[model samples]
Target: MDLAARSPAYEGLAIELAVEDEGWHDAGLGDLEAFARRFVEAAARRAGVPDDVETELSVTLTGDAAVQALNAEWRNKDRPTNVLSFPIRQLQPGERPGPLLGDLVLARETVEREAAAEDKRFADHAGHLLVHGMLHLLGHDHIDDETADAMEALEIEALADLGIADPYADAPEHL
Candidate 1:
């Protein structure tokens, strides 16, 4: 999608979207602006973001090659991942957030494969990943078992608000 198609604001949240993969259209994810705006707002609300705080987020929908390149450059991993979150600033506990939240990059092929493997709708799975990435931008992490559980719980709650099923439910050990 073009920059002009990016959503300017939603409940004080501004989203900049880049659709670099035509596969997103081929996969039938029609009009991601509204979908993304709604999910991000839901996540911010669940994360206790105040109404007055304005935030900015960028999302890129691309193929595995682009994501793989990013992964190799940023994280030193040469393989592609489902989603990548790059938070502009990591907030401290009880710290107020800044205007620029971060960016999210999603790989269409990997996301689609994972969704099919998990028996989830593509839209729902993508929403889950968006929520997961948003939480990361909001200073949540799954670095350890305790933190992982906490983050997972938060994800479940946020997804619940969106009428999405618990992504961890009825899943394989690896998912």
Candidate 2:
């Protein structure tokens, strides 16, 4: 059975959580509902998905070791990244999405460290990654210049909806 069919709070968005990091608990980021709502709302707004449409995804919060393994296995990278996204499927414009959009894996320590280095609030940085991962699930990519521009613009706009500044603004010469 579909998990969304069994839940009441899935009013168009459902996020299954796999939390393996204790840091999230300390940072008050372990609230799956709050983070999920922020991510899903940002994605839906950018993708033109209506508020009443049902959608779902999964999020995993883990330590650097765990994320490093996934990064090596998935992207041939040996180091830990702040976030990694696995998109389940692609949807055309105006098409209804399935129950699962994709999975987002986050490295707790890496994210925290990056936020501190960048002089950003942890929640804001985390929110930016969630928005980024959510966009990837919706078939947005940054593989080329044009797509990267589009993707970045969408990300900036969606992050604005969450009251987050454009994460790329501080990037040197980036939009």
Best by lDDT: 1
The residue pairs in collision within model 1 are none
- Residue 92 displacement in candidate 2 (angstroms): 4.9
Q: Give candidate 2's error at residue 126 in angstroms.
A: 0.3
Instruction: Tell me each candidate's TM-score.
Output: 0.89, 0.85
CA RMSD per model (angstroms):
5.9, 4.9
The local lDDT score (0 to 100) that residue 33 gets in candidate 1 is 83
lDDT of candidates 1 onward, in order? 0.84, 0.79
Best by TM-score: 1
Could you tally the backbone clashes for each prediction? 0, 0
lDDT of 1 by residue, 1-175 (tens): 7968765434567899999998887776678888887777777777777756777889998999999999999999999999999999987433556889899999999999999988899999998888888888888888887878888888889899889999988865422
User: Which whole-number lDDT from 0 to 100 does residue 100 have in model 2?
Assistant: 74
